[model samples]
Target: MNLKDLPIDAQPREKLLARGPAALCDTELLAILLRTGTAGRGVLQMAGELLGKFKGIAGLLHASADDLKGFKGLGGSAKRAELIAVIELARRALAEQLKERTVFSSPDAVKDFLQLHLANRSHEVFAALFLDSQHRLIEMKELFRGTLTQTSVYPREVVKHALAVDAASVVLSHNHPSGSVLPSRADEAVTQTLKAALALIDVRVLDHVIVTQGASLSMAEKGLI
Candidate 1:
């Protein structure tokens, strides 16, 4: 059924205006952004299917343009562009918040930021979040790629970039494409190695976070950092 067929109060736009965005379900919220549906599928159904296809909003956060292509309601450039833009805006907003406050103050935001940047990759990516003395974000850099191992992620290169950014501390991150957020033995070793190397330069290793498509694990919280 089309959105117009729904009761006025039940429509996503009208519901949001009357009761606020939080009153809407995920499908309703997404339908607002999608605006319209394909020939047979209603906008609400399409949004729900899209969420299911991507495994919910977190999975959608990192979807690339190519991923949207050939999708039913997203065949046109406008819908695809809107989705991509919204996702990017979410990322940038999180980044701005990190820059404005001590990262630890909102630890979940740090994880969310890293997840958005690191998760959903087909290969391993090792990255760092350089922080100022106050632990505000300086920058996030992808320092190495391929399988994450102690040998593959060079401490020298990480140290170099940390120095270049003049980071007083760093939060290390990497993605496990296998959908498990558990750190491997190599992950722990690399974290310790990078921690010791950064310590020599007076840079603290705040944490090492492991991210997958829908979840994250913080080594620091687990006392591994």
Candidate 2:
């Protein structure tokens, strides 16, 4: 049956309008984005199939443009483009939120922002958040990207960049493509090296956060710093 043929309250769009977006489940929300259906399936049914095939919303969001283009209902260029655009907009909106707030006052916000930015990535990425004396964010930089198991992180270069940015403090972060939030021995060694090197220049190392697909771990919170 057509989505419009359903009872008004049973419709995803109507339910969303009646109860707001937060009231809709992931499938319902996704169906709205998909907008239409195949010959015998409704938009909601197609959305559900896509979610199941991709392993839910995270998997779908993490899928590459080429990968999405190969999906059944998403094979069309216009739908694939729409999906990619929506994902990028979400990332940009999250970044804008971070820019408007002070990192020091909201440590949780930093964790949330980093998780959203890096959690779905298939490869590892190392990033730094530079802060001024007042702990306001000065800059956020991605210093390196690497394979699943390792990324070459340089203490000297991190120090150089910190000095160039004149950052008073820094928060370090990297994603584990393996979906494990546990920091490896190399992760610990690199954190300590960077901390010590940054200290020589009177810059403080606040935290080193290891992000995974589902969660993040803070070294400072673990007393590793």
What is the number of backbone collisions in each predicted candidate, taken in the order shown?
0, 0
Report the C-alpha displacement of residue 105, candidate 2, in angstroms: 3.0
Clashing pairs in 1: none
Report the lDDT tens digits of candidate 1 across residue range 62-167: 7889998767878789999999999999999999999999999999999889989988888899999999999999999998999988789999998999899899
Model 2 vs. true fold: TM? 0.87
List candidate 2 segments past 4 Å from native. 147-151
Model 2: per-residue Cα lDDT at residue 94? 61
Per-candidate TM-score against the hidden true structure: 0.96, 0.87
lDDT of 2 by residue, 1-225 (tens): 567878999888999999999999998899888888888998989899888887787667677898887878777899999999987787677666666777756777888778767777778889998888877677888888884223488777788999999999999999998878998888888888888899999999999999987689999999998
User: Which residue window of length 10 is worst by lDDT in model 1?
Assistant: 67-76
Best TM-score goes to which candidate?
1
Predicted structure 1: lDDT = 0.92
